[model samples]
Target: MPTGPAATAPRGDLWRFAALSGVYFAFIGYFNPYLPLWLSELGFGAFTIGALVAVQSATRVVAPYAWAWVADHTGRRIRLLRIASTAACLCGAGLLPTPGWIAPHAGYVGLVLFLMFMNTSAMMPMAEAALAQRVSTERGLDVGRYGRIRVWGSIGFIVTVVAFGFWFDRMGLRWFAPGVVLILFALVLACRQLPADKAADEGAPAAPPLRPVLAQRPVRWFFASAFFMVLAHMSLYAFFSLHLDALGYGRDAVGLLWAVSVVAEIGWFLVQGRWIGHGTLERWLAFACAVAALRFAATAAFGASLTVMLLAQAAHAITFAAHHSVCMAWITRHFPGRLRARGQALYTVLGYGLPGVLGGVAGGALSEAAGYAAVFWAAAAAGALAALAAWRVGQAAHKALSATES
Candidate 1:
């Protein structure tokens, strides 16, 4: 195993990280798209399902930072990753109804999910922090190398989404709990494969204060853009499957739609290195948000048309994959070395956490009241706002650069 930067890391070590990403996202692939459907099958209303799904986001609000603080301070990221994945696997068993297990009542289910998410939610930030340390350079993240490894996540997602779509279609969603447990078990095993290195920062100088970094104008605008961009995505994450199902789409069709988006996402990650350098990360972020607006609008207005939905899903290349790469680049540049873990955690909190809570709950109510289409309309509006914020990020970054140069 290479103990140095990702550039110097052996190919096998990089592949291990790729394997971990693949399995971790494989767990997410089935869980995100199917969890609501499974809950609905258990007779929970849309509002209840939304709230339950929001439990994961709720954990993201505080859990990642808490975990990151420990990782940063102790430099025990891989150890924590293993522990978290093991805990998540154990918590996942609570979802099953073995003899004497509690029934899948709403409260019981929510509690189990909450505990499970508390562990699982922390895994990504820790893992990303570790990986970023390898791939990042003084200039920024090595977009191509990073994308090559990250692309495995999209591959895992698509594989499970499509396969389990067929599985649920044939075997019924009663198997959802078992499937979750199995994936989590896989996650635990993957974590065990990661090389355990000693603390990188032991006896090193103290990291700079975090507050001053947060105070920068470009950072503020960048987070603002992330908030709205993810807020826009919340509609899809929380309700897109339900929306398709409500429109009479079958489980197989719903899964295929999701797979379409992942396919596009995979393609972008595979080639993003070539295109990402053509413009500034901030500019790319703005373009991605603009595409997000258009994507959601199509889903809202023409969701019943498979062709339109497929086209909309294809834009995931830009809206999700590209946007994520840009954000990773920005985070790598803004928060380097000792601050890396917390920076990724903060992105989880502001970018995905708060927005997810709002989008899930509000979207649920909006779907229950006006219909699922209304939620997408609102998401479209949010995407537009994200584009504006990202544009401001570009302006702020340029101004900061000029001031520094002068």
Candidate 2:
């Protein structure tokens, strides 16, 4: 059901792009779970673990836009994507041997800064920017289709996570770094196959200034609500795996729970076209924010149970996937090609960089003091406020679009 980049691509680059995402995200699933796991095994606690993960999210505050500016103005999106991929591979490759040397002597604090932030961090947003070109700019492409191609990433996530869990059970975590390095190299290979965008490259149709469009009220609210949603969701990224591991869950089970969550994300990608087509942007945001509140609350309320945790995480479809598709469509409609990169950068800086950092820091403290339950309850509250912002945003978006049409 999913169209490849080339199908929409003037050159049939659809499958190639899909491969790119699949390989990249596969590496993410392959290694990310082990990041905190490694820290814990090395004798760090929840608070310290949180501090370590912060570097990764904090880097987005600067790097994505910095790289995106180059992609946009330089008309070197493909080349940049390739270079970034190669850099990421090199970074991941470097981490493979560091555990034997720097991890014990130099310490995880340094490695966290290096591995999470410096190496594997910038891969996703840059790749998303290029593949996102396939979506409908104005009306938007069918949302349901994404589930198919995106599912490969989920499959990759599931396979590696489960495999690593089993492998670690028998052998230990030493295998994680090597697996991650291999996956990054796979991504580089995939990037080599992606089709070039002549329009984005040849500088054919330039969109207007991003600053002017972003200056609008609804757009401002759009970002504010998005930031809250990401902030609310950050706890899962911060602590879900650690909590499970502490509760006596095996490595395999931990990976399975994560796999289930991504499956929900995959489902959302598949049906996004059908689901988002029915609602106005404001209503979509409202639903996603409301869902975010409930999901976090559910995690807080019955988090000790694996079933409850899986159910809550599965809400990733509405909370994350739907939220993203709507935001992408909104940007495409309101901003032009020239500034889309900047618009995305603003989205990254506000929604990702600032709130993500806050969420990581606060999640650590909450997990340490109030326990995981209270941490999730606060995230739920953040989602409620985000929903309110979306209500006002919906009203503004409708009014703005009506004015434009009239």
Candidate 3:
């Protein structure tokens, strides 16, 4: 059976992990909120923007698993991560619009976005797997401390969004691509420094097949819940900045608003190790789902109210942080040893990839038909569905335990 780490890591390892985490998510912070704004600035319509986002998400559905399969089979997990990170950094340069000659037409920009996201999509799963494996397979490393190291990513996000938001406030949105390239360059260096997986030192066996892990009932329900939970965020992710801009909130303020949500996410990451131990995973997931429902509803109803918007942003603690912690811990416990990388990839595909694709297409159409607010209303409904799925997950957990006991 799998287990959490039992001992503290050296300060050196902790700092290394923290730095890598920070650099990695710095790229995400830049990409997630601003990409659509950049697209809009380039003259893409709402539906076209959604289509581009959907294309990127569709690639994720294939990319992560393909990359993970390579890592698990080749036993070069860290090596693959480094290559992807480097290539992605190079691709970031393509997003910039050249003056006069090429102003980044829809087809060209969409292709670049697809390739860029595809290369970078597997980095998260690979990084998480590498760190978890490093902690578990080594002595004197505490698995419970993973969140503490990971929290730096949230900090990096805050800095990027706020600083870049401010910069873009003064400058134009055209600088967005250059800013992304700079951060991704830093990320490339960060990826090179991660420790190789000790389990693959030599004589390590290939990962066990994926069917057995997928066969578990809790895993299935968790993914079902997670798919909806992530799907609900599509409105916010694809258009939150645009929504704020449309409402007359300047870019600087929009960046700060994004920062506010991540600040809450950081706090949750700091305390999540303790929080995960307090309740059954099912209960934790259920609460997150319920909070997610309220969060999106608040966004739909009171998005113009700064007080209400901040409050909704704060709820990201439960919606993303708590939900994510539960998912990570569950995977750590069940998908031990050689299964770690593939398992993380599977989780990524289910929780993020599929949701991004479906939600992007649907949210784009809905926002165009009704309004941005309608997208959030639909998000609220998805959250409710996720909560119901979490309830089913809880039931399934109870039944499994009872069967094992009997």
List RMSD in Å for every model shown: 2.5, 3.1, 2.4
Q: Where does model 3 exceed 4 Å of error?
A: 1-10, 98-100, 136-144, 199-202
TM-score of each: 0.97, 0.90, 0.94
| Model 2 worst lDDT run, 10 consecutive residues | 1-10
- Candidate 3: what lDDT? 0.81
- Candidate 1 lDDT: 0.91
lDDT of 3 by residue, 1-406 (tens): 1234443446676577788889878887887788888778778888888878777677778888889888777778778888998988888788766423587677888778788888899888877776776555333224257778888999998998898898877888878877878888898888777766555433587568989889989889988998999899887888788778777888888998999999999998887756666787789889999999999999999889999999999999899877887777667766776677788888889888899998988888888999888989999999999999998889988999899999
lDDT of 1 by residue, 47-79 (tens): 999888899989999899999998888788999
**Candidate 2 residue runs with Cα over 4 Å from true position:** 1-7, 103-121, 205-207, 402-406
User: Candidate 1 — number of clashing residue pairs?
Assistant: 1
- Local distance difference test, each candidate: 0.91, 0.72, 0.81
Using lDDT as the measure, which candidate wins? 1
Measured by TM-score, the strongest candidate is 1
Of 1 and 2, which scores higher on lDDT?
Answer: 1
| Candidates ranked by TM-score | 1, 3, 2
RMSD of 2: 3.1
